[model samples]
Structure formats: structure tokens, C-alpha cells
Target: MSFDEMDVESIWMDGEFVEWDEAQIHVLTHGLHYGTGVFEGIRCYDTAKGPAIFRWDEHIERLYDSAKPYDMEIPYDKEELTEATLELIRREGLESCYIRPIAYYGYGMLGLNPSDCDEEVAIAAWPWGAYLGEDALENGVDVAISSWRKYASSQIPTNAKTTGTYINSVLASLEAESNGYVEAIVLNKEGNVAEGPGENLFIVRDGELYTPGLAESILDGITRQSVIEIAEDLGYTVHDDATISRGELYTADELFFTGTAAEVTPIRSVDDNQIGSGTKGPITDQIQTKFFEIVEEQPEEYEHWFMPVEQ
Candidate 1:
């Protein structure tokens, strides 16, 4: 869904707020031409205390981490980026919205080498409902095993959320949508289950939970880390590293996806095979419930994960 002009009027560009429609880069921007950039999708929730950003420091750290490989130096320090993001959210008066922090190479030299290009950063926040669909949160979504294989870390830094690498994701996701499924479950170069387009995959069987590790060409998602912790806290053994075959998904007791956008979305079916009971399973509900509690209510125990922003 596109944001209305009224929904997001102000955008933080480099250290100043500008009209949302005015935040633009030259057509020859290096990142636009060659896709040399890094970005982070963070969520701010309307918790009881106020509008708090989830894993604020972690996202900022990852933002820097994402830029490191490209040799892109974000001019501003982490503190500046963090403050800019918070101020942008406050300025927009958005209580619950998706926050995007992107650092890209700006126009300078049109040559293939972006080493001499300038690193530009911007932050924007606006209300975005469930990424898949509103019903997808509870009823779950059907996804196809994309013909597109995730690039190996050796080919590119799959661990980093580089913008260029997402072309592979785009192809996979487009294939799924064109084929009528809600999303795509992409496999890695080695034919092992990697993850969804923008989310990590978790499989449940025998009451134990499992997800592919960084070795599987999957991102080190903060939400994935939270789900592992929440599941373990509930006395469930969660394996951070697991080699999941495409066939394993069809027979799993329950399957779900985790990420900043998807949150805790259950996967009801893959290739039309009903996963478990074909609805959100017991363990999935338990984990999702606890995860939501932390984000929405700002539970006292998990307060450290949230950074409160003055509304």
C-alpha cells in the first residue's frame, strides 16, 4: 500500500527533516544505478508506555553492519542516525508504523565503481499494516518453493541486508505472487531451505522448534532472535541452526515466519500441503502471544528490548 501525502509528510534526510515528496536522489545515484546500498526495516509499536521502537540499538548496529561490506561510510554516527529515526517518527505522529533507515551511494561518478560515491542516509516512518495480509497473521499464508535459489554467502554477503541482493528475493516473491500464493519460500544455492523473501523460516516438529542459521544464507533477524528466546523461555527447545530440506516443510508439525515486518506469522501450507492442523498451532500461538505482549504491552521483564519515544 502506498502512503498518502498526509500520512507521511516529513522525512529525515541526512540530518534534516524535509517534505516527504522532496526527499529525492538524482536519477544517476550510484545506488540506484548499481544497487549499492544497505537498509533496515524497523517497527515502532504503540505500547502502553508510549511509542517504543523494538530493538533500537540492534537495528542501528545492523544498519552500520550492513553498510560495512559495501565500504559505504555513513557520514553521521550511530547516535545521530538513532535520534533522526526517533525524531522522524515523532514528527510524523505515527504511534505504530514501519521505520525504514537506508544508506546508499549517491550520484557522483556514474562508473561501476562506487568507491568514490557519497554515502547518503534517510529515515522514514509510516503506518503499514500486515506485510502479507491482515488475515495472514492468524489464518496463515500459502507459499510456494520458489525456483529462485538464495545466493550463497560466498557469492555475496547474504548475512548483510544489502539492497542489491534483494533482486533475488524480488524474483522469488514475484514468482509466488504471480502464481497466486501469498509469498515465496526460497531455498539456498545448496537446495536447503533458506527463508522467505524478507522473513526467516521456522519449522516445528516433535514439539521442538528449528530455524536455519546464518550458514544457510539467511539474515540474522532480530525478530528471529526474539522468537528463539521467547520459545525457549516457554520451556521449548529451540535450535538456532538446522538444515531444513524442502520436503521437511511439507511434513512439519507447524511452520511460521519471523521478521520485523511479518512478526510471528504462521505458515498454514506450503505447495498446498496443510501444515499441522492447517491453522496456527499451539506452540506458534504461544510464541506469538508472548512476542506480541512484549511489543504491545512493553512487559516489565522484556523492557530492555524496547526504546520508548516520547509521543
Candidate 2:
């Protein structure tokens, strides 16, 4: 839903809470012109305990890490940003919402060098449902291999979540939608399966899980790490560093995408070729079920995964 349709009223910006409609940035901002900003996408879930942020610490760490390569320093500390987010959610009275924290170079002299630009930060939260659609969570989605290849780390730091680097994803997403598919699978420079537009890819074969390693030009997704742990705890072997070819996707026993938004959505088909039974396979179901259970129930065994908003 758009911000106009939500009940949100305020956004935390540059150390203060401002009216959402008033949270504006100048057109001359360096980040806007050069894409020199870093950001994070986080989720606050209504769990059995209360409203909580899932893997908030990891997200915050990534936000800082993303800024490092650009030589940008966020003006606020981790505690500052964390408190600001919690207060924003509490003030907005949000039960479950998607949280976006962005730090970018503010208005400055227009040039390639951003040394003179001031750093600006803002946090906003809004309600969002299943990213791949609700039905996709159960029935799965159809995807295609994008003609656009994922940029290699040599060209850009693939590990960093820089705002400017997302043009690659935008192109891939546009191609997928225009091609009458639900999503796209991007390959790395070596023509091996890298990942989805925004999510990490996982393949299940012979009761073992295989995902491209970080070297495969994919983000080290927080959700991907969580799923690996959960699957291992359930007695499943996960090959976190496996190199998968494009052909393997069509022959896999099952496949899925993991991300803060997509969660554990299954991939039922690739380029119209049925994956296994062309449905959410049994292993995918087990892992997806456990993922939702942990988020909704906030079981004590996995308590470290959540940060209560009330705190």
C-alpha cells in the first residue's frame, strides 16, 4: 500500500520526528544525483510477546557495513537509530510493519566527490504483506532467467547494500514483469546461477540444501542465514557454499527464495519448466512453515532472533 493509504503520521529524520508529509529532502542531494547512499529493509512482526523487530541487530550492522565502502558515516549511532525506530513504531501504533532506514549524502556542491556533503538519515515504517503475494507463499511463483547478468564484485562491491547499485535489480525486475513471469533469476558473470532480483536462491536435492556462496555475487541475506540455521536445527544438511548452474534449477527437487521481504517463498517453475511437482515441495513447506512459526510465535528457543519494540 502507498503511504497515503496508511495511518502513519511521523518519520524519524536527522535526530527528530517530523510529519511524514514534511519529511522531504532537497533535489540537489548528492545521494540523489550519484546514488551514494546506503539503506536497510527490516521487518517488525507482531509476535506472541508483542511487537518485535526480527534480526534488527544484524540489519543495523549491515547498514553500517554498507556505508563503509562509500566512505560515508551515518551521523547517528546504533543505539540512536534503534531507539528512534522503536519510538517511531510505538508512536505510529504499528502492530506489524516494514521498516526502512536510509543514510545518504545530503545536499551539497554537485560533483563526483562527496567529501563536502553532509550525511542524512531517516527511518520509516509501514504495513506490508507477503512480498511475492499471499498465494505465492503456498502455491509458489513462476520465474525466468534474466538476460541481464548480475554485476560482479570486481565491478562493484556486491556485498554492500548501496542505493546506486540497485539499477541492476530494477532492470531485472522490469524484464521479469514484462515477460509475463512473477520474478527473475540473475546469473553472475560466470553464467552460473547467482540469485533472484532481491532474494537469495536455495536448491533442495536429495534431501540436501544448496545455496550459492557469497562469492556468487549475491548478498549475504539475513533471512538466508536464519533459514540455514533453522534447517540445520531440524536435521537438514545445508551446503551454504554450493555453486549451482542454471540447468540445475530445472532439475532440482525443490527451490525457494529467502529475503526480508520474500521470506521463504518457493519457486514452482523456472522458465515455465515445472520444479519438482510444480508446487511448494515438501521440504520447502517444512522450512517455510518453521520460518513463519518462529516469526509469529517468537518461540523462546529462538528468542535471540527478535528485539521487542517495547524495550
Provide the clashing-pair count of each candidate structure.
0, 0
lDDT of 2 by residue, 49-93 (tens): 999999999999999999998899899999999999999999999
Candidate 1's TM-score reads 0.98
Q: How much lDDT does candidate 2 score? A: 0.95
Using TM-score as the measure, the top candidate is 2
* TM-score between model 2 and native: 0.99
Q: What is the C-alpha lDDT of each candidate?
A: 0.91, 0.95
Q: Write the per-residue lDDT of candidate 1 for residues 74-134, one digit (tens) a residue.
A: 9999888888888888877889999999999998998987977889998888897788887
Once all C-alphas are superposed, what RMSD does model 2 give against the true structure? 0.6
Candidate 1: which stretches are off by over 4 Å? none
Best by lDDT: 2
Each prediction's TM-score versus the true structure: 0.98, 0.99
